[model samples]
Target: MIDPAYVSAMARYNAWQNENLYGAAASLSDEARRQDRGAFFGSIHGTFCHLLWADRMWLSRFTGTPKPSVPGSESSRMIEAWEELAAERQVTDVLIGDWAAGLSPEWLAEDLTWVSGISRRELTKPKAQLVMHFFNHQTHHRGQAHAMLTAAGVKPGDTDLMLVDLRG
Candidate 1:
């Protein structure tokens, strides 16, 4: 059983982690951030792009926001410029905050059925399951990006859920 507070807290943590991730990225050279680190997405920028893509996909299902122009596209957008990507990521963080705040406990137990752009098939699952997967998916890939960033000498800030500001 997932509490609504837990969802909100996790959303805050996600936003906080992303802020730190992009902030650390700011310290790295353009070539370094783009270097291949063998991550599933290849580079920090690439993983970050895919992470945002996944976030947008889930957010669309969760809140009915506009989907991307390309569905299920995983190739990292050529955000060759770092500052733009970071700024947009911050906006995404705030959007995530509002999205999480709107969710109720009952909504999590309902089901979501949507056309799978990746598989091109109709898929259905409990909203709780999908939401859990959404956050978990972010954490998992972000961990990969974090490891790659650390290897490249960029240290993201604290990741503990306890450190996230509840009022954020």
Candidate 2:
């Protein structure tokens, strides 16, 4: 089980890593970003889109916010336009930080129950564990995006959590 400070730190870390990943992704042409690179999500743009969609989905379950319109099946194609996707991502990052900041120990200790869109099954689990998975899922996909960006000749810079300038 995790605590509020840990959640806040991870939230900040998520935003910092997102800034780096999106900055590098922004440098690439739309065609390059959308190009099939044999990743789990097909391309850099696709991976980013899927990550955003999943983030929103988890956030919705955790915070009672609105979920993404499309299901996980179409997550890779969530937002078609680069501008819209980027804008939504920036907004979601802030929302995530705010949500993490507001979390209470009592809330984290409770269990969350929701139906899985992908598996079509009702599931219940500890909120603390689910929150960890939320951040973990972002890292899992962002790593794919980072690799794609690098292969396309762009660097996302430092990814280590220790190097994430929390003062920002």
Candidate 3:
């Protein structure tokens, strides 16, 4: 089981990495960003869209915020435009940071019950473990994005967790 401090630190790392990725992505043209690079999500824009969609879904589960209208299968196309996607990403990152800041040890120790979107079944698990998965999912997709960016001749800076600035 994890604690609020751990949650907060991961949240900070998430936001920091997001900023780096988005900033580097901004340098690419629309066509370049949308080019199929043979990645799972197909392209940089598509991967980012799916990541944002997944973040919203997880946030909705954790905070009771409204979930994305599109399902996971269609996540890569969640947002059509890069500008819109980036804007929503910034907003979502802030929301995640705020939610992490409010997490308590008691909440972390509790269980979270929710219907699985992928399996379409009711499931319950420890909040701490779910939170860990949530952040891990972000890292997983972001790593793909980072590779895509690097292949496209962009540098997103250091991704090491120790490089993240915890101070907000």
Candidate 4:
């Protein structure tokens, strides 16, 4: 249902959006970044942390990497320090890109099974579908974060995937 090219494009888009969001977030005071903004994840910092945590969790499933230590309920606070979070985000972005670059059609075509941490039940699905959800989840939460940043008077630029020049 998906191809490596599509995944690669998404990985690049994810990194680009993250760079813009994190750059805008860096301008805010720590208090402002962490303040509860009534968002689903609480605030910009909280939302970003959750995104990172979720990405790591999904990556762990896709790869053989260790899953994130924190649970979904605590994901919002997964990385408390701003600088550390930013550095980790950069590293995770690269990891996702590299992983996507190496995906094979045979691998993506196979079914994947894993226990659901949230539901506490065994779940199975096509790898392609799960891969699509992985990127989709990032975009979903990033939208929430973009709104929060805008509310804080911080401007994260050009969220449109089409506008991202991935040619390089």
Model-by-model lDDT, in order?
0.82, 0.92, 0.93, 0.94
What TM-score, over all chains together, does every model reach?
A: 0.91, 0.97, 0.97, 0.97
The true-versus-predicted C-alpha distance at residue 136 of model 1, in Å, is 0.5
Question: Residue-wise lDDT of candidate 2 within 51-151, one digit each (tens)?
Answer: 99999999999989999998788999999999999999999999999998899999999999999987799999999999999999999998899999999
Who is ahead in lDDT, 2 or 4?
4
lDDT of 3 by residue, 1-168 (tens): 688988999999999999999999999998999999998999999999999998899899899999999989999999988899999999999999999999889999999999998889999999899999999999999999999999999998899997657765
Model 4 global lDDT (CA atoms, 0 to 1): 0.94
Off by over 4 Å in 1: 165-168
**Residue-level error in angstroms, candidate 2, position 144:** 0.6
What lDDT score goes with residue 118 in model 2? 72
**Root-mean-square deviation (CA) per prediction:** 1.7, 1.1, 1.0, 0.9
lDDT of 3: 0.93
Q: How would you encode candidate 1's per-residue C-alpha lDDT over 63-151 as one tens digit per residue?
A: 99876555455447635467877876787778888988888988988899999877889999998888788889989988998899899
Winner on lDDT (3 vs 4): 4
lDDT of 4 by residue, 67-102 (tens): 888898999999989999999999999999999999
Clashes of each: 0, 0, 0, 0
Model 3, C-alpha of 49: deviation from truth (Å): 0.8
- Among all candidates shown, the one with the greatest TM-score: 4
Clashes of 2: 0
By TM-score rank, best first, the candidates go 4, 2, 3, 1
Instruction: After superposing candidate 4 on the true structure, give the runs of residues whose Cα lies further than 4 Å from its correct spot.
Output: none
List pairs with backbone clashes in candidate 3.
none
